[model samples]
Target: MPSIMIADRDPNERTGIGWLVSSCAIPYEKVLSAGTMAEVFQLMESQTPDVICLELDMVGKGQWDRLKLLVDQYRPTVLVTTAEATFERAMQGIELNARDLWVKPQTPEYIRRVLTRCCQDQSYRMQMSQETTGVTGRAGEVSYLDLFFPRPLHGRTYPIMLAQLEDPKHHPELLRFFEDYPFRDKPVLLPLGDVIVGVFPDDTHEPQTLFHQTGKRLLMDWEAMSDAPLFLVMYDSKEREQSLNEKYLDAIQALHIRFFKGYRQLTIVERQVNWTMIDPFLTPSEQRLWVDMLHGGDPEVLKQWMYRHFSYKEEPYPEPGLLRIRLTSILAQVRRYMKSHGLDNGDLEQEYHRVFETILYSPILYRIVAEMLLFIQRLMDLVQNQREEVRVDVIEQAIRYMERRFTDSGLRLEDVARHVDRSPAYFSTLLTQKQGTSFRQLLTSLRVKEAQRLLLETSLSVGEIAERSGFVNANYFSKIFKEKTGTTPRLLRNQKKR
Candidate 1:
């Protein structure tokens, strides 16, 4: 049985959810409801439900900060429900780590399915916790073990490395031997027998002793101490499936190692090998990819693998260019995926293009990564650094230029593009690529924003604001303004006055 909490402002909506849960016979021990953000947090503290279904629109302005705090503290699987499901709204939900999003007019069956999935997910997490002994322990105490499948051990057909350090024959004698050894607690140890393992002990105990003796032997054999290390790389979507399906896994497995699959991600285990011995298996392009993946941890063997693999290739230019091309293609694919899934606004496409351009032209791979990170950081720093460099600078400029000239009545995008020193077609493509919105939409938004500012910040009447903002007719402006803002300009002005 799962406990569920519903956070919706409408009384009818709360009642509707209550009835749905009851009809499903979900074995819900408690069904708590709240109509405001404050109530939601209060109820959350008191009830501590297994799941939280939040109404996206009902949340008041600036409530996301408090919502995120509650989410972090409780760690409940959140399901966001909203009447208006836009890419911006969906992205907000994703940022908050909401597990799923449901729109209004949802069928009872759909609601039941979502709740069931949430329950199943919770059960799976609990089961994994029991199996892995709660992965949230101190890093030192957490034993880092690597399962390596060097040359397909024992003719096992499955592509997995199952190495356990608990084997008695190899580890027991070593543990006993280390009982009186010095340097027991100063340094970490890498143990090797049939498998490789890195042990960091929590206490001055036998496990530490075993690690010292066994780690030395393993290092002597492989000439290195760390166990398998995994790296996660996020690339563009189209090439992602192909990259994952193609060289990404094969390259890591070429070292005869184990890896785990994740959504558009891979975790690779660290391998210990002589630099001179394994330098024959990587191309320059492959080397860059490996380095990119190794950013999370120091998998130096991967660098050695790259060096060895590319030793025979005399040409250096093609490899880096190829790597950049592959990365750019991946980024483009990711943008397409985001658009198709309605996960982001169209602006991502333009941002992706800019990132791709910057990365491709950069002299070094590390520099490219640094610049990309800085761009993302700038975009995220919207509250401060009011005019900071962002991935969307080009689009922002276009929007500003349009807003300044929109009152001209006969203002055209071509004229705007000329002012920006770009061709009309190129500017159009850029706008569409970055804004995800068409030229008409940009123009309309500029007018709407201006209308809103005038209504809220000035004493101008609605009709006057509409005319000054470039609408041919005041009535049409009022209609479009209401459509965009969900409030008539006159009403908005009245509210501002009060």
Candidate 2:
């Protein structure tokens, strides 16, 4: 006969949560609903519930302290809901000892699972407390959780497993997995900041192959629960001069090998980690080779080069930090290619920045390589498309060059002709023949159009706008502007204001 309370600002959300809770198999004697903080407090004061579901957004700043006090006093299993899935909200849940924090609009199945898990946890804790009332702990008796610090080893050795997430910042989230692990005799689960160390009992005598199989099973189970990659390093401690703490450190060092081996697979470390020496920076010759390949624009050749250098794995692997540095060297050449092709701005620039960050922070080499290959394919496609478009019309190419440099006050017919690989005289004659306008006339029209746009949109003075629009002489610019638009720059701006 457990009682539960559901609190939210919206009536629909409150009813939805109540329905989901009722649909769960756990039988509840009372299902209370509250739409305000005052109502929630009234319900809690009147009837002590076994569980509480609260929306954090509706809780005002003044109510936080009182709510936290009530929660600590009643000690109900609390599940908080939030509109924003941010770290601050999560920290608030941790402060109230909430079992879970659900973002708004969660699926019914997920909500049910969370509620069931919280209820189960509450029941288990109550049962354990009752069973250990008189036989809790004698003086000087050490608990298994104390194994994290320096302790007496007595020259004993035990099999240990170091479980770590690909990104160690998520170590707190990993604790839930060990809470309901299926092990018959649960091992001592120790959290050492970035990694979780499980120290098995001394009676364990599993073979190396069996230990590896168990590690794989645990990894598969974790993958089923979370998408983040987990690295589980197993080591059977042979009676050596090292303490349990030292063995744990050795396993942590072994995790670096995943930089080469990739993640989502169990690793069995038999000995110390060994890293070979390597020059992380590219040599002058390699830089030249990268430039040549980029210029060649052959995807097959670039693919072969990537596979040959990065995909081939050998013993005594290079240090991961150094390999990351070398990857940046390759990116340097790619950046130059992008700049040469005018791909250094807008979406292409953002894509390049993403690849740069992935190279620096991605946990596995295979993922970095995969992202780089995809970016390279996009770059090659864009380059080929630009080449085909330019080949279709030389006059279009000349016009594009002029459009890009029209803001430069010193730009002339020779510059556009050189960009399209034609002499000044030939280019001028071709321009008039195609567009029925002289080069100077076309350039002036482009500049005047830009000046008119600036007049309408910006607050700049007439002289400043004229200079920005590639007009050196203010008087000439004013005459041309009037001729083109039939109004002065100041008059146009004043008319728009009216």
Candidate 3:
């Protein structure tokens, strides 16, 4: 049984969570509760629980820092619970390496599930640690590789499937060996096969040796197929586990392992991947289309084939003109489609696949596809605002733009676009793209702001100021002005004079 701790500020919240945990009947040996960060620290000193549930907005401002300290010291699996569903908070939770995030007002089932998952994960980690310590006695002697399948195989026979994967021009060297060997596919060969069994490793190894040894083991295990190879595939990079399965390895191989280093290590697994679809040597535009398709979720196999044929790295093929423009335009359309649909970060990978599949075969739609992906990615980045200073700068730029030109008569999108050195359409798209609001809203805000300034600083009639501040019609201006100011412009002006 695992030990658990809950830290939250509200008494009712603490009671609610305590009751939920009890009701769920989770196997916790001891459950500790703390209302404040200080109490949490004190509780930690006494007992180190297997799991920690933190309220993101608990008690005070320095709670996160304290939480970090607790996490570092105890190294428990942490789950953050918060009422605020903001990107910043979400990112902070991510940065803290929290096991998961739970929204407040969570249902009993949801809480139960999260706790169970965390505990199970903790148990798995403990088991793996023990295994790594060589308690099972198979650490260095056995080789392991994970195999994943995107879809269920058509048949149960591994040999037939290996043959399907081995078409030399299509599959990699590992797959090709199975294709070239005929006797290895005999039914009699299948019965004697301890030759290829999937093994899961408890310990992590250096990439080169891991891949090399695992490959050698598969070939050695099967007698007739001495040259046959094995590989590991990782499904989602987000999994905390060290070794990836075989299916993910197939995907990576299909991508042709485009970017290679002395030893493959990724800083941020998502961004650092120079996916097979992206040709490093292609023109920016061509590269853009490939990148968009990659993010859009182009099939790993097809992308690998394309990389093999079209990638600039595979020299001697003449570069195609207009590839960049085509890719950019397509990406722009994708961006628009995503925006109108209200999709979020979780949807990005799936949507990328959907959008790319929609345009992959098209001959002239490359630019549109590339632009759309770039647009979507930029929007995602803006929405997430991973860096605090970046978010502040973007907000400040919009505020400053409004403040400087609130009183200008022709304060249309085109004017702002020109100031920003973008087309009106592009600027409008950018504003909606970045701020999640339209230009009209921003402009109206600016006008209403000036209305307040006039009411407070100068003795001008509401109508007089409304017309001067770029409101064409007085009545329409008053309606908007009053809606924004929370009172009629006339009353505001009168109140100021009095």
TM-scores for the candidates: 0.28, 0.49, 0.27
Instruction: Name the candidate that leads on TM-score.
Output: 2
Give a tens-digit lDDT track for model 2, residues 1-498: 567899999999988878777776666668899999999987875676779999999999999987886675456889899999999899999998988889988999888888777777767755654453321223222344334455556655666788888788777778768755544224566677777887655443445665555576578778988998888888775755556766766777787777777777687877767777689999999999999999899988988898889874756888788999999999999999999999899999999999999999887898898899899889989999997666448789888888888989999888898988889998888888788999999999999989989988999988899899999878888999999889888889999999
TM-score rank, highest first? 2, 1, 3
Worst 10 residues of 3 by lDDT: 183-192
Tens digit of lDDT per residue, candidate 3, span 74-172? Answer: 568888989999997799788768888888778877888888888788788666656544212133332232244233322211211112121133334
Q: Answer with 1 or 3, whichever has the higher TM-score.
A: 1
lDDT score of residue 7 within candidate 2: 91
Off by over 4 Å in 1: 134-498
Query: Regarding lDDT, does 1 or 2 come out ahead?
Result: 2
The best candidate in terms of lDDT: 2
User: Lowest-scoring 10 consecutive residues by lDDT in candidate 2?
Assistant: 133-142
lDDT of 1 by residue, 1-498 (tens): 557898888899899988888888776678999888888977775566779989999777788776775565456889998888799789879977898888887888888888888877776765654454311224332233322322211211111112223232545444332322232122233344543222222221123223333333332322232232222221111221222123223432322211112111222322221122222234567556643543323334433543443233221123444555654543443344345434354565567667878766643454455455444343334323332343267667778888679876678888887877778887788789777988888888888988888888889877789889999888999889888989988888888778
